[model samples]
Target: MAAKPVILQNKACTATYTTRGGALVDFRLQPGGINPLQFRHREKSKGSKEVFFNGHFVCLGNWGDPSAGEATRGHVKHGDFNRLQWLSSQKERQALLSAYSTLEGLYMERNVALDENAAVLQVTETVQNLHTVGRLYNLVQHPTIAAPFLDGETIVDCNATKGFDYAFPQFSENICKTWPCANAFDGETINLSSPDRAYSSVFSFLVNPADEWGWVTAYSPAQQTLLGYVWRRSDYPWISHWLHFEGELIRYRGLEFGTTGLHKPINEIWGKGLVSLLGESTCRFIDTGDTHHRSYLSFLHPLPKGFQGVKQVEVKDNVLVLTEKNTDHTIKISHQFKTKYAIQQ
Candidate 1:
């Protein structure tokens, strides 16, 4: 094969990959528009990519769009972009470029995979310190699914209690929350049918400590298919949930996985666990630093007619355990069934 862009499609779905950034620019299910995905840039000059599934938007980002700003901006304050100075110069750009190139190469090597039955699509990426110095970087997975699947007919069920209450002033209180627990499933999943009329776009769910392996799932009421994501925890520590209910933009829900809380300081949080680079010394660009890998699996399951039951999904023990080490290493696993389901049609 000529190593062309990878494109996976079947009777039910389609996904497009680009080697430039090893990004999923296009993903869609048949009979599209259920979730219309769009990518936007804070600076108009910055470029972006919009991914759609079933006509609904799933993910969006620069995806090798050179126009997108090379620097990752932090939380804005008082209409100022001060916190974004982390990567403001040529030196920082060069460092980021080196790290990003490594990630891009991984994406090229292990970008997309389809299950044997063709019922799932898997995306994988690995990050290795290519230079002699260590580097700090930010990574996030932005996946959006249709909200009608949950709000209209289906419901979201997870093993969580009270929802994380967001106290931040900049974001919408109803959209985001601060989770006390480090793991998912401890945070409550948003119930679209709540009578309190309190609906949140951003919330956290508790993942089984055993499954500390990361993942997100979406089930369809009409199709009786469950779309699940099983990800590696070493690369992504946190997962973010987003829903678009009242906007004209698009009717959808998002399950974003990442290294830190969205719109929050992840490096600080991960640094406490010694997983993320903390200070300037740890951010040096050296090949002698550590390497990490994150994998995500997406698959579909056919639900029996009238199937409606909640089941406790457990994480694979071997998959979630992490060994503490002062040096870098590699972690790999073949994880399955990380996504639970309550099929109702």
Candidate 2:
């Protein structure tokens, strides 16, 4: 009983969203262009419930795994949001999708709208606690990029400041570094801004506390296109970058951002007191009958030849501007959307 995919279109872009788990299956610029978020094509992992981890799915209720006690209660590995079916309705270029997590007694409603004149998708998710008691939760936007949009020539740029490696064996978890430079498991330093098959790792970085918005961009010089996302820094303070490699080729890259950076079971996260490490909150608690809202914007932009990378992204007065790295060149898009935490005037 898998759900069918819904196509939402605009003059500049086309987006396909599947009701099953509410995963975004495809997002490509109009007129037959490359989709950078085609992770389903290279996905090889599935949960015990037979749900495939594909496309750009949200990791709600939890991020990685469930606690031992929760597992014994038949809890799925990454929570029920991605495994359960969601109800959806569409109106023109906007769609509303809703899903419930029976295990956690949480209800989620999402609204996705594509801009009429720009290649930008605006998403807002509202989570409400239905239980009698307060509950802790995690919500992560898992947008994975795969080939042929992802290759050695694709460059990833972000505004992350400090970060720590998750699975590095040689380096202590306390050891920290800035963005794009991480200590590999073999104790070697690896650059993350570009694709490199030298190391496959997962690293989480803290967004600059001073900035109101956090953004990540992937630019492919070969296709002369760029895909990027911007969200409220107050809502998603951490961004986790996962580099999955197979054999001698890079497979998928995860540009995940959420409330939690420690991708472990609940008990471990609390026992180790990794909640406030690096001054970033790992989990959020929702009081009974209370609701929380989070929103973000994802857009596609055409790049000029010899474009080095992204220098900065700015959103103001319902307009988005992107600056090219090491140059004064800029691209601007006009929209009617506003982020929860707009840049301070």
Candidate 3:
């Protein structure tokens, strides 16, 4: 027999999978703990939580590598990847274990399996809390994309007019030019060519506080294809942008989206009221206890000649709309209650 269908294991990795959802193809071990090599944990720890696309490092936490000479800037940390800290409490550990067991397969197979013939690899993960107490915290999905796939030739075109410009302060004196569009504020979108440009990241996508959702695309000009697509939903409103192209570290770019603004702590931005509590309380807090779902679908498209234009896409009332002039594509990905949780006091 093919070695009981128990969770797959190897010397450097151990992971579970979901036959119903083709999720988590791999969960490799790192020095700290298990990093979801497929789809990393979203918070602030960077790749400490997950790595994707064989080389696409999905840093589920905040900030790039601290030792990579970029620590002068600020990076926030949420409770998502603090497994050692959770080990202190039995209840907390059990709750985390339960959540892990439910989504283990996603980390093992879906993240590690590379189907050379396939252009897109999509994985979905859901975590539900059966406990009665509320859960307070911040969650984010970080994916560190490689430089070869997103180098100087890459271009990002968001249908929206406004975005957060990260190359400010450093280049304000010499490279201050009005943004191309009406909504391109001075704080949105930055070019990497400017001097004094320490680093460039975009964090200005306003999401729905009730159910925030957005997508990030990584395309390879040489290959004339989209490397990946990361779509997420949450109750938080702020999104963070991180771009890295210097130092001895891997030359990769990252566009992280989340519920709160970059550089602001979750507790401070959401306030003590919004924090997910373990117990029931009437205090002011924003509870995103409901099921939050995110998925990444990789697709390969043929390179068209000068195919640069704005593509209008949105998910409204559960319907995904993709419009480009008269050519439009629509897909429906609705779940009844795939993942559920509650925020207690």
Best by lDDT: 2
Q: Can you tell me which runs of candidate 3 are displaced by over 4 Å?
A: 1-118, 129-133, 159-198, 207-213, 228-239, 247-250, 270-298, 314-345
For residues 211-324, write the lDDT of model 3, one tens digit per residue.
Answer: 434455444454454433435444334344455546534255544444333343433334534232212111122233344343444323334434442254455443344433
CA RMSD per model (angstroms) = 12.6, 2.7, 11.6
- Preferred candidate (TM-score higher): 2 or 3: 2
The best candidate by TM-score is 2
Candidate 2 yields a Cα-based lDDT of 0.82
Backbone clash count for every predicted candidate, in the order shown: 31, 0, 55
User: Runs in model 2 with CA error above 4 Å?
Assistant: 41-48, 169-174, 340-345
lDDT of 1: 0.38
lDDT of 2 by residue, 246-338 (tens): 876788899988888877776777777766767778888889999898889999988766998988888787888888888868888788786
Q: Kindly indicate the candidate among 2 and 3 with the higher lDDT.
A: 2
lDDT of 2 at 166: 82
Ranking by TM-score: 2, 1, 3
What local lDDT score does residue 79 receive in model 3, on the 0 to 100 scale?
Answer: 26
lDDT of each: 0.38, 0.82, 0.34
